[model samples]
Target: MHFAQRIQALEKNVFADMDRAKSQAISKGKKIIDLSLGSSDLPADPEAIATISASLEDPSTYGYLLHHGTLNFRETVGQWYSNRFGVEVDPQREVLTLIGSQEGTAHLPLALLDPGDFALLLDPGYPSHAGGVYLAGGQIYPMPLLAENDFLPVFEDIPSQVLGQAKLMVLSYPHNPTTATASLSFFQEAVNFCRNHGLVLVHDFPYVDIVFEGMTQPPSILQADTQKSLSIEFFTLSKSYNMGGFRIGYAIGNAEIIQALRQVKAVVDFNQYQGILNGAIAALTGEQTTVKKTLARFQSRRDAFIKALNNIGWQVTPPQATMYVWAKLPQTWENKSVEFSTELVAATGVAVSPGAGFGKQGEGYVRFALVHDPHVLELAVEKIAQFLATRT
Candidate 1:
């Protein structure tokens, strides 16, 4: 059997590796407390589910779904973006529905790059972001993020030669793994940098609604390029509506980028069945109170978990946004992210995502997903405390 060379550049997946170990532990009678993946433990909005259920009886929606059939979903996306960000959008040209934002991220590369063009990506970025680039045969120039910079990549650091070959600059905030949020001003600066370098700006906005109190609402890349002439931002119902399993999402921004992504998508798969689109439209156009309640739940979990970890002697800062708590590993475990994750899960059954899985620059930190309830989180912390106490 033969496989593509791209398959060799990446391993099966580090998160899956942790899952197998966790499963093995559970099989041996360990009480597994999984925090490895970020799939929401919350239920999908009843309204959205109800909307889908009602649509199923209509045989009209059972046919092949194409772009024309998804117009209403696109219009809802445009209105949602306009209301959320105050940026007027033309749904006809600037919106495209995706099976999930992952579909867009993974497919955009094919439209933007001709094997071997460079993509400037976040160093501790979502794994699939890098995988998408590699699958498209593009070279990656990682923009290493650091704590001192508030986890924002330094625009001045990219080399001049690399800029010319770079066709896209991918960024996400409230970011994954690091839980960092970028200000609109920072986004404006990024927009100017990308414009000056002639690069397409792609923003993965899955965590747009996962922000917490006192922090400003993170801006969409579209807001930075208000004319919708140079950038596109992707949104998913997965994080906000607890609809990860539904796999519905959309892209709103530059007409060119939308068209390019649409071209790639059209060749791959048809638009999602209309019932799912109807549910997503309901998610966007219906009452938004659910978002605030969801935020409150995650915030409570974040506070209790951080406080518990601190009391147990792990000095990690509270994250401002996203569902992750990026904690610097203890001195004993620093730089040994995978080992620490494996040993901790094996010993305590409290599974965490290893930072090394993100990138080499992420070696000293471990990411904890705030998915469990406050009390369960506290229990996980206590188990972690016991493991640390005897971890010599």
Candidate 2:
């Protein structure tokens, strides 16, 4: 009946709690409009799917895939990174395939942090970041991402003592649950800071391509550390290529970090299906039209959803990147994010993520994923308006 202490830390996921609430609502015959998770509703690119379909016929791909089997995918990732960011990567040494960037982010702590070491994490960061550090028995020093600072962590504010014990600093942009993008200048500053502090810089870059409004693409962390001296970045096909279910992503940066993560991965499990890698290769190297189309679709949804919320008097800034709208709660619901989210879903059958689910600093906001089509998003907003009317 006894379980490892680590299991206790993993127990309190707000997303899972919301899922149970949603299931109860659905059971009562309430039609559900879920904007909770960021899982894309878009289909994977046909070419990518076709490539995987073709691979399924190859019996050789059915066997367990080892590290060497991932070389082609790694090379593709390297070339993709080079083409996208002007960073030359040694595929053999620098690239490691992952079962989604989540796998890389979650498994990384084991390689970087020993027991009692500190990880400087952004408050309201992606939940898995904290889970990873906890699993590794690492302490977390949350760096609050304040609105005044554009939701980016102010590194200098980190206590000198905490900084001294911190082994790694985790950053993501456009950040999850916040939809804030960091500038190249900020990344440059982070690089210098981490270099000076002798801490590894980890950037979880799932939203790299989900940008909008003719904005410049988000810069790679490697763009700030061209030598990859103290940095590693994780990228996922889930956001850009609509391959979330396929679970294909990669880690690129410090060769030492990649090797350490790979060693951890080897001990845990072998690589994902080789066919999925083929699909990922097709996604990265194939015509990027699907990627562009995906961006356009999300942009339209973002515009429509923001307009609808504004029409209902819930003013929120349109996000420049990522498929989410992070809105501060109204006065009545400001400090009751979990209750507001649960009650809203119960009353209107519209499910969204309570910001408190992400971290303590997320207390007065909610994150709405723009995964549905514009029409459905507008409908969800209409329902939200009705729910708010009742509250008033």
Candidate 3:
């Protein structure tokens, strides 16, 4: 069987290899503490669940959901965004309901790029962002995001030549893997850079509500001045509403980009079943106190994990948002994220994502997902300490 040249460029993933190691460890009867994927263990809000349950008896929801079928969900998302961020979103023209934001993130490149066009991506950004560019036959010029830069890419470092050839720049605030939040000022710079280069700006905003207490909330890239001119931002219900399994998300910003992504969707999938869309609408437009409670729970877990690690003599800063700790590996395991993750699981039954799986620049870290209870997190860290102590 023949495979495309584009598909061949990607190596079999390091994260998948870690997952396999985890399975083997679990099979060995090692009690597994999965800190790998960012899947939420929390329950969906009762109102949203009730909406879905009630819709279960509605036969109309079983049919293929076309573009316009998501109207209520889109309007709810638009209002939610406007209320939360002061970004005006027109449900009619500037909104697209996604099966999940990953779908939007992975497909938008196809709509935006001509073959061989470049995409300026964050190094160690969400892995799906790169996959999207590859599937679009676009070249990825990863802008290295380093610690000194607060894990935000510096537009100045992107080669003028690459920018000249690029069709889009993908960003995520309250970012995945690194769990770093971006400032509005940083987003304004990105917006200006994309405008000057004639590149589309795409922001994946899954963790927008997972922010910690005391830190100012992160801004949407669409909050930048050119957002109305040249940007589209994707939002997911997975993180905030604990609706990951429902696979509901939305894209909002400029009308043109939203239209293009919607058109791309028209070719690929019917919108998700209408019942899920209804449920998403309930999650978005209904009372949202669950959003704050979920944030508080994760914040508590983040504090517990960070304090436990620090008490055990491993210093990792508690992230301001996102359900992850982008921990730099200890000196002994520096530059071997995969090895460290694998060994930690093998010896301690604690699963974590090797940061290198996110990108080459992610080599010195491991991402710890805080999906488990604080007590479980405390135990995970204890096991990690034991594993570290046993290492030479």
Candidate 4:
């Protein structure tokens, strides 16, 4: 049997492989302490949930929801953006509802790339970013994110040749896996770079509200691209409102790009259940206590986890934002991240994401998601210490 070459690019998946290792550990009677995936374990906002429940009773919401049906939700998103970032948003022209930010990130490439067009992507970016490019038959020019540079890509390093072929550039911060945040100056630099090069700029901003105390809140790309020129930003309720299961998010920015993405979306599928959008609207417009509480809880977990790792002699800096700790593996295991993660999980039932799984530059490190409570995170660190003991 034959399959599309695009599917070939997805044949090797790090998270899927980790899931199998976890299942094997469970089969051997190991109680799994998973720190691999970044899914939030926090509860969704009660107001959001209540709104969804109310929507379910309305028979009008049961049928197919076209673009017009999402007007209310999009208008709410536009207001939210204006209030939070002081940037005016024309919801009707710029905001497009998404099943999740992943969906928009994955599908937008279809709108932007013709076969073999180039997309400038971060080397250790979220996997779906690459997957989307591959599916669109687009070539990828990986921009290395080095620790020496605070895990930010250097625009000057991109070869003139790749820049000539590049159609779009994707950025996300507070970044996943690395948990690195970017400043407004950095975004301004990015906006200027993309505009000069005639490339569309896409920012995956799922962690927009996940900053730790004392840390500067990460800037929106739109904040830098004040006129929404050449840029589009994707936001998900998954990280901010704990609505991963609800599959709700939206894209806001350049009107032309948003419309093109909407065309691609129309061909793929209609909108998700109308009730989810109602819930998202509530989460956006309602009191933000849940958002604050969630950020504080993740910050507590970050402190506890970093302290516990340090207590075990594995010095790791606490992340400023996002719900992950990116740690360089000890010297002996630096080049063997996949092996280390696989064997450690099997032996200790403590699962983590290998840095190499993210990309070539990700080698020599591992990422731990702070999805568990502080106590459980500390316990996981204890198990990690025991596992490291045998390696020494």
Candidate 1 residue runs with Cα over 4 Å from true position: none
Question: How many clashes in candidate 4?
Answer: 0
Q: Against the unseen true structure, what C-alpha lDDT does each candidate score?
A: 0.90, 0.94, 0.88, 0.94
Over the stretch 132-205, how does candidate 4's per-residue lDDT look in tens digits? 99999999999999999999999999999999999999999999879889989999999999999999999999
lDDT of 1 by residue, 213-323 (tens): 998889999888997667988889999999998999988888888998888888889987899999988888778767888899999999999999999989888999999
Off by over 4 Å in 2: none
Colliding residue pairs in candidate 3: none
lDDT of 2 by residue, 162-243 (tens): 8888999999999998999999999999999999999999999999989997789999999999999999999999989999
TM-score of each: 0.98, 0.99, 0.97, 0.99
lDDT of 3 by residue, 1-392 (tens): 88778886565675678789999998888888999989999999778889989999999888888887778887887888788888777899998889899999999998999899999898898888998888899999988989998998888888888877889988998888898898898888888888888988888899988888898988887679534899888888999899999898888888988888888988888888888888888888878888988998999999999999999889998899999999998999989888898888988899999989998889999999999999999999999988888895
Better of 1 and 2 by TM-score: 2
